[model samples]
Target: MAHSSTASDKDPLYLEAHDDDDERRNLCGTFWKRLGFVGVAVVIGVVSVLGLSIGLGLGLGLRHRDHVKFTTPAIVTVPLQSSPPSNFVLNGLKGQPPQTRVYAFNVSNALGAPDGVVRPMLVVNGMFPGPTIEANQGDRIIINVTNNMDVPTSIHWHGLFQNQTNFYDGTSGITECGIPPGQFLVYKFGRFLTFTFGEFSGTTWWHAPHESYRCAHTFTDYSTQYADGITGALIVHPSEPSPPDFPTWDQDLVVQMNDWYHTFSSQLSAAYLSPFGIDGTAGDEPVPESGTLNGLGQYGQGGNYFNFTLEPNKTYRLRLINSGSFASIRFSIDNHPLTVIEAEGTLVKPYTVSGVTIAVAQRYSVLIHTNQTVQQDGTFWMRANIQTDMFTYVVWGQNTDVRGILRYSTAPNLAAVPVAADDPGPGMSWVGDMDTSLLVPAVVDSPPERTRMYLVVVALENTADGRFLAFMNRTSWEPLSGTTSLLLVREAGLERHNATSFAPVGGSLQDGDQFYVTEDSIQVVDLLINNLDDGDHPFHLHGFRPWV
Candidate 1:
């Protein structure tokens, strides 16, 4: 959101903060304020060290909550002839297991700007919005992640069910300490997705789950890491199909989108989690700098932009992933309506929509037809608009209208941003019916009655020390020293306990607080959440994808 700019109104700080190439370090601490629960889901696609993200359950009928960090590199180091991922159609690998695959990534630091400017960033394999990693259902994957940077780091396979391999979940404190700087870890991909679709299919993502003994809860610590550049796409394919109604398309395209911050995420987090917060806005969240589609976007930046080329009258399968850590995004193409076919790896009956409102950590696969008459030399605006209403403390981006170019016959290299062309005329909007879609075949069944019901109150509260904090119930979470929660719980087998508690020692890095809950036995459970604040919030139950 660009504010009214006049030569007379310009200030050095404003000009410097706006320029990604300026040699300014953490200048945002002087500019402004906001915050969220999501890995700070990182740092809305930046990378985090130490923590591994895990999926607790993959059952017959539900999808679990994911808070893993997603990342993208700042520099555009993609070699020649690499196209955006395919969409709409089932992936090439079948879902049947009995296979193993491995990929090694060197995580390091770099300088570049996804929004066409330069800034400090974390990179995986020299590309931001990291490369797409695909595997068939039931197959094993070995992700060999090497820390090539000075800081410790890790990767959590966001939506995968780590069935028996809880240690492999990549949760730093809860699973294992992060890979030390100059160290490497081989994550043996566990068998996660076991529920086969009789006639269903969908998409999911992997992000940084910043694990920290410190700042395990808020923006001050690991939350800001992955918000910049470390997110990637993981596509699971089914081996066979029982239904004959799945739609087929010529090209499959993966469109990864999320909200972005211009200043360093740590700086944004400091402003967000500041004492009493910025300007006395105790519960306000930090507003993001802009939004991105596939790791590239330009907000009011002239010349080169992120664009997609298509052939007229051709159907392209598009997989949409919300890779941001905080802000929710709504997407729409100038003249095209999308036919959504899948949600969160679960196949549903195809539905149409003019645009979609996507929350953080959500994914959808839609089919778009390039049937529009070539206008503006076959160029149209593809908007990835941030939902400002979903947040409270938006210091900037009040007019977050991030755009890219789309053309049927134009070269992919030539594109621009926010160019105003006349509307494509009044168009129809589509509302998603998750309930109806869930009833489709291959539904996983859950036990009828819940053995235990956990009540969580989502709240924004002041700590005893007067720090403004976001939490569930009343307790702030702090990780245990030297070991993870899983190992602790496993070791406490003979000890009588309903829940566990530990206190932090004096003089540690000031981070947010987090606590934990443990179950006595394996019984079907119910989670009841009540919001104590008025603003928008996304609640996720780490470990299991439960039926909602």
Candidate 2:
């Protein structure tokens, strides 16, 4: 893929994304491998407006959302660990110069079982459910990711606006080519070079933790690294003190929940993309054998459960992120109500509920008061149940409820704890189940008057060749071989174009796939996403949090 330079090539912004000779070779296989697994259909598109752009894409599976009202139930909360992991402790940001935080990520292959089934896994810094990346609003975050795996890989800073550093967006072939096997890439967000939290601070995550590690170089796409471990919690605290109206807690905790599979993602992807389904059910996504809370759960044989020790009569803020590749999870504790304060980083008026349902790639911040009396065994079950009803088919004896122990500091013997009798099955109504959309943001701003609009209709297409693919309108997104849309846009140079003239910007737009480039300018655009699939889809925008 030869890059044709235009007059604007010397511009500073374009220079920032320019690649060297070696990188050009790596970029060829980068995106194609990252997104190669066509097993699950995903649609990605970019719409530029207001000098910013929105990168929208569909999550794992379409979800069926049940609308529930906000409730103010009597609730309690608590955090994990005797003290916050030193790495994740939030330092004061007020009256201090911003600091640069560095994390060394060594992405490699390992073997571990989150749910008792040992399998090949991808790990970061030798830890499954990788270390927490905690930073204050304005602090710089520099993660030098070294790919020690045999395959190429990339990391996406999900939900973070890359601002001027679009190359660090970490979508192979889209932003910049992925790092090659045994190579390294420095992802800098925060400070002036790449990103600054600015006014935004909230719960968001990276895939594989950007777990879409490009697994195989074969024609099929495989990005199951996150599923086979390699994901973690990323917490960005508000630099300013909690507003007087915001919910407060004595301690903060992080819990990352996800569906677990015993098999490697590559194998599962191969089965999923096979013309014949796993068990004669074509187009049925692979059902997970179990679920995990903070990367620990159990199956028939052996596995450890995550435990959160709490002090009595204390309020805590629990940050929850669903980093799974699939499966919508219903999270709850035995005898406590969760008071929702934040949804995907937006502070909201306190809304209480017994349990909250979160889909893959979604996040929530809830405060619980640990005021409940200790159980007889001094342990409560923190249940993360897979909404198995959403699956197209069911596997026998598949345990959907993944439980963790919530023990109090006063418990006489932690080893004597028993599972809660009332821990229910999938789809069973946990008391006070609430829909996140119903919660209102603490501060609401009206969108500017729209000057343009795009309607993207999403649906599952059963192609003539007997394969199920997801499409946005008439096009399904396949990466441009060996190059990225951003690269092409840079080569061609940026120019303003109105809605009527908008067209694909990269190489020849293939008949079944498409990618577009938008000028970095102002245009208030309203995007309407219509999902025609029976299931639900969680759409995520990389750099913008749109008002839904």
Candidate 3:
């Protein structure tokens, strides 16, 4: 009634002070209490601010944990194999049980000499290009890999697909995480059915893809801690016991082609970057005493030198695998003619050629008649001719070297050798005549299903900064950076017209453009030549096996 102003009508500053006073009084009562309240408020504000700052710092710290500066000590393990595992034979066609066995292997680096020549690396079964696993088409195959190294390792069944039974696919992330060091992984295949014809009949291989890493052409040594030396071949033969017109045998021979590294800078650079250098600074160094057949380095050297005794007139099947990192081989006997019956593991028409060019990831089954009129010294020289281009490292510019020897006869008198029986070895033999039966064109029983095309272009770049760059399919392989996955996606997304962008901007085309795609259930890969050598590319496909 006296018109006294309400608390809301009081001066703003006075009202604010009054509210603060009320708050202080509510928090406490006496003068000492008010001071205590003010102190408590200040403490609360400080605590809140400190808590927020700490929480934000912790979040940022967690987000950057992977970026923390920390050098990981290099972990090296020298792989060892107590003994070579027993080879398996394909006996299913002969009504016999399929041969299966377990193999143990180690992966480690081979320390080089003190002269800066030897570089440590990851190897398999104590050898670069691990042991060869041989079996016939109808045989049940089981491979037990024990990773004794300090990192995770996996085996990819290149060119072989498990189809519905995807469990047998050896891809690290797609099928399994692979076997970590000190662990064993069992990869089983061929238990379901036998391959009648097509892709399964040819040469196939296995290698470690421990995660995504650079391959030959992109990186100097090819990425992956184990790629420099840890690779191998898997040859699956036809169910038929005899290889066409060839004679059978008690034992088989596996020739592994490979390249060895010595310089830490060269090896490490190649392993993590490009194998080919701009001028001559990076890539494979000439291994003075490397290169082996069955883990045996040079002939007559400490490496595995093959010395097999052949009956004067008996025939032997040579199962050859071109497992070299970047070498192409021209294999022929000194004075004997060689017959090629299969290529890439598939049965081709038995054709006699002067010499077969074995590129990377290629397999050939041939019948070498030790039947040469026996001379006291009839030596069949197996040589691997290196094929390089302008892009090839000058360090590897040398002529062919003798791979191994095929001693015709051990008899004192070379001429008195008897003709051996033509019985197909202990394995299953094909029912019909290989020449006529395999040639009869069979009718198409099913209509084709799906189709896709892939254009393969090799990219080469000689930068102004003296840097050389090379790539397959126009995409430069980024070593260990794990950028290939993204590049592959971008490649797959481009339209036909946009495909040109895939090639290197200013690089030359070592190999021309070629497209590979599946059509109507059949996968068709066409290799188009632009500037590539007349040489063939032992192109290996993963997931699905091709018949060509």
Candidate 4:
């Protein structure tokens, strides 16, 4: 992985995905290790499920997606890895001077440890949890992504309107081919964007959007990718002279929370996707081994933590991001009430909350005031605890709660305040839930009458080689290969050589496979999503933010 700046040629390599043998080997090993019996008793149990039909490659009521080999035009050279540029631009979006911003990210395993535990994690610019990209609404943003790993990679700016740059949407094989190993790719934004909100910036995130049940979280091709790392927060500022709606705040804090695991994601995915469990029962999605706030936490302990310093009587706006792989967490600061200001990217009518429930991949901005006298010695605990017993996974996470500190003192990385003195504050009762129907959108929710309506049922079925497969309207999303569905349609006239040039395979079939929709004319689509799964799943529709 030597550093070079230029790349040419469409590099395509077949990913050496784990085979049945490799998968079974992991299943045999992990199930034993997970049970804490690496000795004789565990070995016998591992051998029992080795005869599963999953490895035989027979679909058990689930339609298997055909793998497509995709190719990209350019590859990036692995210039020597370096720290993030210290002087990156930050625009308030109220009326920024610069119209363009540049960002360089080296997708590599070389970086400081997240969770303070050195594991096989992918990072951006050598930063775990990645770096935040703060820019004005109208500014052009260019991101140079260099893939230094053995596998290909891609990045998706979730919730952002790609507008004219659909290829830059970053859904591998669907929008664009991935950046190959030792190669680089550039994603450019704002080419076709007309920001009506003047310099608008909103809270969004960038992560690996090439969704494979295996490697969906991380932008890499491998299954265990995101579990290792490769996610970050992005804040878009509207204009330089930002709208003066802010009554005011002294400081702004970005608080990101997630569930962590010691085991590789692939291992857990293998089990979660497998039809049979390690002990010859229905498979269960592996629970997180722990939780982290801004990439710092340990099992059942506040190892490295998210610490906040506040001057007395000052109001600080906290941007809360639920970056968990899969978990809805309740976020709250003890002895403080949160004033909800923004939901997603839209500013909401300010509302008070004792604790807010954050679903995965969701973002919120709340205002916290330092009104209370510091309890338990000038400190309070900021809690992001997983809502257990709500989700129906057979297994449970090792650590249920992750706590950080809210200190009145101005210090970076001070020794932890004594937990013995930690008071959760006359624990306020968080009853029921937030009323979403009552919450109003900052922008008017107006659209042409829905022309096409779809009732999508989200469920997990005992199919796909005997594994628990997630589906939408019985259609689960699997990556497409060769040409992207986008490219196929946009460039439909480019190639009429094949009779089925733009046709989606098995798309017309029912009950569990990827579905392709193509409307020759622009049509408003109303999707009525019915969540059949016992657990609540966060639904995010890319390309457009529809009124819910």
How large an RMSD does model 3 have? 27.0
Number of the top candidate by TM-score? 2
Candidate 4 Cα misplacement greater than 4 A, ranges:
1-94, 110-113, 192-200, 213-224, 240-246, 278-280, 300-302, 374-376, 390-397, 410-433, 443-448, 491-512
Candidate 2 lDDT at 204 equals 77
- Give the number of the best model, judged by lDDT: 2
Q: Write the per-residue lDDT of candidate 4 for residues 150-229, one digit (tens) a residue.
A: 88767877777554445566665455556667777666554343222232356777786424422223433453355556
Please provide TM-scores, in order, for all candidate models, with all chains considered together: 0.73, 0.80, 0.57, 0.73
Each model's RMSD to truth, in Å? Answer: 12.1, 12.4, 27.0, 14.9
Predicted candidate 2 versus true structure: per-residue lDDT over 166-259, tens digit per residue: 5677765466557677787777653354356655588877654222222223332435566767666777777776657676677777778878
Worst 10 residues of 3 by lDDT: 45-54
- Model 1: how far residue 279 lies from native, Å: 4.8
- Candidate that beats the other on lDDT, 1 or 2, i.e. the better one: 2
For candidate 1, what is the total of clashing residue pairs? 65
Q: What is the C-alpha lDDT of each candidate?
A: 0.52, 0.60, 0.39, 0.53
The all-Cα superposition gives candidate 4 an RMSD in Å to the true structure of 14.9
TM-score of 1: 0.73
Q: Candidate 1, residue 429: CA error in Å?
A: 7.5
